[model samples]
Target chain A: MTPRIAIQEESFDLAAETARLTAGRQDVGGLASFVGLCRADDGLAAMVLEHYPGMTERAIARIAGDATGRWPLLGLTVIHRVGRLEPGAPIVLVLTASAHRAAALESCAFLIDWLKTGAPFWKREEFEGGAERWVEAKAADDAAAARWTPA
Target chain B: MRVLYFAWVRQRVGMAEEEISPPPEVRDVAGLVDWLSGRSDGHAAAFANRKTIRAAVNQDFAGPDHPVAAGDEVAFFPPVTGG
Candidate 1:
């Protein structure tokens, strides 16, 4: 199984990524994907994402590995962009492939939920008029992740 | 040990990375944070609200009581807001 993880400042091509994962693979029957976009808020100019160099990739890979362990996935791809980004820009992408849709869908959700809380990236909102503030963690995200915890 | 800060924690602490050698009694993440807080006003400000801070020892999520030792790459940052 091919599991691709990338962190870069450049934008990613979703089609190319999906093609790379599925190329020459006939066992894949279901593919689930999620793309996270930067939101435009009132007076928001840009959002800057900061991350720890070695830890970010490690954390995401660990989460992806956990997903693979829990589900019968054929392929997994996770890409996260850093640096300054304007509203509506893509910030992250998660794609999961499996022989069945149920496994693909559940693993996709699991990967994203873990990524939200476990990944070590921080977002700083840059607003117009020169004001800036760090984005705070949402309890809702924690709750979302908690639901996946084994009882 | 190498200590790293990220996001607003970096801004508050005023640097990205540094080297420190804590005393032998500084055995865990919380102890390291408390020891680091005394280094300067910037550290104190960065560590002021412990609730907002998170830690990783050797790139793994570590809790307050997580044991740490010399030569570990300890990182401190605010709670993750990534997707």
Candidate 2:
């Protein structure tokens, strides 16, 4: 199987990632993807992402595993970038492939939703005037992830 | 035991990682937090609001009541805000 998880500082090629996921696989009928970008809020200059070296990967892999178990996913790819990033830069990508669109779409959503709260990454935003602050977690994100809880 | 801090927690604590031995009464995450908070003003400030802090034991998400022992890695940070 192709590598399903990547945590790196370099940018990734979406086309290449898609090709790799479907390579030699005629079973994949649908693909869903989500890309997260750094936002340039008022006075925002840069955003820096920090993560625990070993725990970050483990947390993401556990989230991917949970998605795979809940959905009929044929393939999955999760890429998260670390280090300083400018506004408009891609920060995360979640791509899911399955035999049908519903599974692909829902699983893609599930992956990103879980990743938002469950992953170990922390973001610090730097404003134009040399002020920096750690971004606070949103209750909305927790609510979003909570919806997927087993009934 | 290794205690790690991240994000603003590290900034407030003034260090990223530290090695220390806690008293026997500090047997779980909450107890550890209480003990650390008393060590210095920085730690006290960082841990002032327990509601905003989160913990992980041995790379797994944990609760305040989670049991902790020697030779374990415990990390504390603010709630995660990643995508």
Candidate 3:
């Protein structure tokens, strides 16, 4: 199987990733995917993603593993790109495969939500005229993650 | 121990990583932050708002009271913004 979790500087091919998980596999009934892109918001020139090397991989793996445990996942892939990236570049990709749509879809959402709060990656946006600032964590993102918590 | 900084913390602290020996009284993440803040103005500024910072000891998320010792890889960074 293609690696279930990945953190690298190079971009990912969504089609290729999807094919890898589904190819020659009748067991997979559904596959859900989410791709995050770098937007040119507020005249931003580019952004750089920074992460803790060993910690980032482990953090994401833990999140993926949680999804695997909670849902019946047949296959999963999480690719997050580091280093400098221009606007319109892809930032992250999440793919969750399962025997049904609900498990595939919900687990995909859960993985991304938890990744937002629990993962160690950070983005530094470089705006026009050489000014740059670290992207602030959104309260809404925290709220989004919180909704997934089991009571 | 090797301390690492990322994102704004790295920029403010003016270095990516460093080796430091805190006094024996410093036993956890919070204590280490307090001791590090005394090292320089930049260090103080980087850790000025403890609420905005997060810590990891030996690559695992660590709370303020999380035990730490020598030969650990501790990292401090702002709240994660990645998806």
Candidate 4:
């Protein structure tokens, strides 16, 4: 079992990825997966994603690094796509494995949470009336990441 | 002196990329933004509410004070919306 973290520009095939991770892992009793999909804004027609080439990997590596340190996860995977993407595309994928389901679930959540707040990436939405800008950080996503912060 | 805006910054600034040699003192992201806001009405309007503005140096997440050298690619945008 290994920790795999990827920030890719190309789309990922979930089925193929799942099969490869689960194969020959009889000792693992739990598998956790989180797939993020595009959401429809009130009237936004198109969405584009932008990120830093070198920083994208570094940001993800830091988040994955945190999860590995805090959890007993035997395996983990994180893959996200950049550039223009349509609705229903998988923006990010996280998979975790452990002897118990709790660690798998928690670590998966941790990865996504940290990625949302800690990573540096942004989006633009094109609407018929005009383009809507996203200047402020998402409060909800920031809250989600804060839930795991040390008290 | 290429100033490439990314994501939300590009949309709000109304320019995807530009090139300019900002004055001395305005040598970093923070200084650059201060200088940009005085250039034109559009710039002032775009960066008017800078509370939402965030910047990076050469593709790395950085604070407003991050030093930027000539030929370095500085990107300004909002907090990330990536999944």
Candidate 5:
């Protein structure tokens, strides 16, 4: 069976991941996937992602578990890359499969939203002149995650 | 206890991890932060803005009031910005 969560320095193949999740699975009628890329905004040359090793995996698994609890998902996958990445490289991926489109699509969206704020990964940007700075968390990302919380 | 730092917090703190024994009065995350702030200028600078600093006790997200004891693994970091 394909692993549901992966945190690695190497990149991933979306097509292969999708096939592995749905291959020979007739019950899955909908599969939604989201891929996040590193943008070369401003004079950016590269981006470095740092994470708390053991905590990163545990935190992601917890979030993935929450998604499964909230939706009738047949399968789910979350891949996040760490270390140094060039502009345009893929940073993260979220795939959700279910019997219907609604569950798969909504769960996929929910996973990414929660991952943005809940995961223990940090991003540092390297500019063209060799200057580097850590990326600041956005309040909007927190708000996005908050929308799912019970009032 | 073992304390770890990440991202900008790590950068400002000048090291990734450290071993420290806090005084008994340091019973919680906020108290620990106050004690750690006196260790050095780097730590004080890293935690200058309390709102920007986040913490984890034994790898789980923790708040200021979270109690911390000896032999625990505590981590200090900035708000995460990952997708």
Candidate 6:
């Protein structure tokens, strides 16, 4: 089955999204998920996501394509939300279905790793007391992606 | 020249996009920024810090030295904060 790659600004329902990803697939043995939520403690009271119209879609699709090619994955879905969002909301959702748990788990992790480092979307966060700032690239994200490189 | 602003940049500039001709003295990204900063109070405030803004020329990421020509599309926005 073809995978789904979307970058949107709307809020998403997790249960509904899971059902859609596993539809019509009896051969699916394992499903792995990774959800990223906006947090209040992290000073991210609100987030504004900005992305290039064409480049955002192409970059996300390429990552999903690469994930599918690297594993024996039968189905996958990627959902990323843009625009303004409140705290504790899901920012991204990645699902993978495969013949075994290891592949599904690995692909799920890989998807997030690649997304953090490769995707072209940018975020501006609002903090308490009316402060705001653009987030810088984290060194941790780079280190996570580096582990997946072939020796 | 068409100057496009996105996201917070749009909010600060109080404009989505606009078409204009660069001043004779405005030659590159940096010079164009200086010119835009003089447009209005909001423009000045948005361009105030200077360090927070970034520019893209013709959909490609560009630096301050990037050249600007007549009829070129220039986009300005804040530094990328995505993941």
Best by DockQ: 1
TM-score versus the correct structure, for each prediction: 0.97, 0.98, 0.97, 0.80, 0.97, 0.71
C-alpha lDDT values of all predictions? 0.93, 0.94, 0.93, 0.78, 0.94, 0.82
Greater-DockQ candidate between 3 and 4: 3
Chain A TM-scores in order: 0.97, 0.96, 0.96, 0.90, 0.97, 0.94
The parts of candidate 6 lying over 4 Å away from their true place are B1-80
Comparing candidate 1 with candidate 3, which one achieves the higher lDDT?
A: 1
Candidate 4's residue-wise lDDT over B18-61, tens digit each?
88887767767788888888877767776787787777777667
On residues A19-124, what C-alpha lDDT tens digit does candidate 2 reach at each position?
Answer: 9889988999999999999999988999999999899999998888888888888999999999999999999999999999999999999989999999999999
Candidate 6: tens digits of C-alpha lDDT, residues A29-104: 8999999988776666798777877656766787788888899998788888898888978888888889899999
lDDT of 5 by residue, A1-151 (tens): 2338999999999999999898887999999999999998998999999999999999999988888888989999999999999999999999999999999999899999999999899999999999988899998999999998989
Candidate with more favorable, higher DockQ: 5 or 6: 5
For residue A127, give model 3's deviation from the true position in Å. 1.3
Each candidate's chain B TM-score?
Answer: 0.98, 0.98, 0.98, 0.85, 0.98, 0.93
Winner on DockQ (2 vs 6): 2
How many angstroms is residue A30 displaced in model 5 relative to the true structure, after the best TM-score fit?
Answer: 0.2
Q: Candidate 5 chain A — worst ten consecutive residues by lDDT sum?
A: A1-10
True contacts kept of each: 0.94, 0.84, 0.88, 0.72, 0.88, 0.42
Give each candidate's interface RMSD in Å: 0.6, 0.5, 0.6, 2.0, 0.5, 2.7
Interface root mean square deviation for model 1, in Å?
Answer: 0.6
Task: Indicate the worst ten consecutive residues by lDDT in candidate 4 chain A.
Answer: A127-136
Which pairs clash in model 1? none
DockQ-based class of model 1: high
List the candidate 1 regions with Cα displacement exceeding 4 Å: none
- Residue pairs that clash (backbone atoms under 3 angstroms), model 4: none
Clashes of each: 0, 0, 0, 0, 0, 3
DockQ of each: 0.92, 0.90, 0.90, 0.53, 0.91, 0.33
